[model samples]
Target: MLGISFFSVVSFLLVWELACRNGVVDPIFLPAPSQVLERAVRMFTEGTLLWHALASTRRVMVGFLVATMAAIPLGILMGTSQRTRAAFDPILSFLRPLPSMSWIPLSLLWFGITETQKYSIVFMGTFAPALLYVIDATRSIDPLLIRAARNLGANRWQVMREVIMPGSLPQIISGFKVILGLSWTCVISAELVAAKEGLGFLIMNGKEFFQTDTVVLGMVMISLTVLLTDIVSRVIEKRILKWQA
Candidate 1:
């Protein structure tokens, strides 16, 4: 599968490069693979690309960790206590569908173009979904399991810490992997507001200068970063969930 995937990507790039060289596709619109690669090298040499990518990565991690930390405990409470769910569910529903872009005006006003605003964009975008994922994961654990824990003389906190957490963790981690991807998207929107450095800013700046190679380079960098993070997440999941297997 890995070999096939590599071959497929190489073939596609070959076709793309040939098409551009033969003028079937305009370089202005879709630059050759070589052209994009050249641009990548130039940016790397100048150190701008690394800095931009790092900025976005930092924002994503901070926002995602904050959201996860807040969501897990609250979601566990919501799953176990009907009254708690009732109190938060209404507002969460309202906030869930709202895009990160929608909060830019208020975030800008509140945080004034600082990194906090960028992190807030990511946090706001992912928090509700993460909360819901945690809630569902906890609730989906069998009630029989809970009863068995209790019958074994486990207290509420012990049942939660030992039984509930382990039972629900696989699903929670899976959900967080998705939410981490979402944080990257929100960071793009975040960097749209007065950010001088980030992949988002790079793309926007390239557009103003009509540097299609830079734009494509920014996009490619985003795809690579997301792929890297996904791999890291899978590694973490494997280690943590090895017991289940």
Candidate 2:
């Protein structure tokens, strides 16, 4: 499977190279693979590529951590209590559909074009969906287990800690893995502001100057970074859910 996938990508790039060389595609619009490779080498030598990757990584981690921390507890509470769910449902409804871009103007106004604003964009965009994922995960727990726990004199907190949290963890981790990817997307919008570094800024800057190679490079970097994070998340999930192993 890996060989096939590798060959498929190589074949595609080979065709793309031929297309560009034969003038079927404009280099100005779609640079050849060699051109992109040269550009990558240039960026790596300049050390900007690592900087952009690290900057984006930092933003993603901070924003994702904050969102997960807030969402898990609140979502579990909402799933376990009807009254809590009712109270928060309207607010979640209002915030859920609002894209990260929509929060830019207000975030900049409130946080003043700082890294905080960038992080805020990621947080705002990811928080609602993440909350929903956690809520559904918690809600999906076997009711009989919960009832049994309560019958054994487990209080609300104990029930949540001993029964609910354990049952929902696997799903929560899986959902947050996706949410982490969403945070990467939100960081792009966040960097649209006064940011100087980050994959998003790299792409936008390339766009401003018509440097499609840089744009493509930024996109590729983002994809690769998200893939690496996903792998790391899976490892962490395995360790945390070792009992399920």
Candidate 3:
């Protein structure tokens, strides 16, 4: 599978490079793979590429971690308690439909163009969905299992620790992988406004200068970063869910 994927990507790049060299496509519009690579090399040598990538990565991780940490416990509570879920349902409904871009104005007003504003955008964007995912994961646990745990003389806390948590964890991790990707989009939206450095800023700056290669390089970097994070998530998932193996 890896070899096939590599061959497919190489073939696509070869075709793209040839199309640009043969004048089949305008370089100004869609840059060749080599052009994007050259731009990446230049930016890396100048120390800007890593800086922007790290900036965006930091914002994404900070916001994503904070949001998930808050969501998981609350979601579990809401999932276990009907009254809590009912109380929060209206708020979730309002929040779940809001796009990350919509939070930019309010976050800027609330946080005043600081890093906090960027993190807030990502937080607001991801929190609702992450909560929903966790809620569903928790509710998916079998009631029979809970009853059995209780029948075995387990207390509520023990039942939660040994039964609910393990039952819900796999789905929570899977959902969080998706939320992590969503957090990247939120960070991009946040950076599009007040950020001085990030992949989003790089893309916008490159666009203003008509530097298509730089723009493409920024986009490529975002994809690569997301891919790297997803791999990291998979590694963590494997270690934590070794029972699944």
Name the TM-score of candidate 3. 0.97
lDDT of 2 by residue, 34-136 (tens): 8878888999999999999999999999999999999989999999899999999999999998999999989889999689998898999999999999999
**TM-score of every candidate relative to the true structure:** 0.98, 0.97, 0.97
Pull out the clashing pairs in model 1.
none
Candidate 3: lDDT over CA atoms? 0.95
Q: Write the number of the candidate with greater lDDT, choosing between 1 and 2.
A: 1
Best by lDDT: 3
Question: What digit string (tens of lDDT, one per residue) describes model 1 on residues 1-245?
Answer: 99999999999999999999999999998899999999999999999999999999999999999999999999999999999999999999999999999999999999998999988999999999999999999999999999999999999999999999999999999899989999999999878667989999999998888899999999999999999999998998999899988
**Lowest lDDT block of 10, candidate 2:** 188-197
In candidate 3, position 126 carries an lDDT of 99
Local lDDT at 41 for model 1: 95
lDDT for each candidate structure? 0.94, 0.92, 0.95
For model 3, the stretches where C-alpha displacement exceeds 4 angstroms are none
Give per-residue lDDT, candidate 3, residue 72: 99
Ranking by TM-score: 1, 3, 2
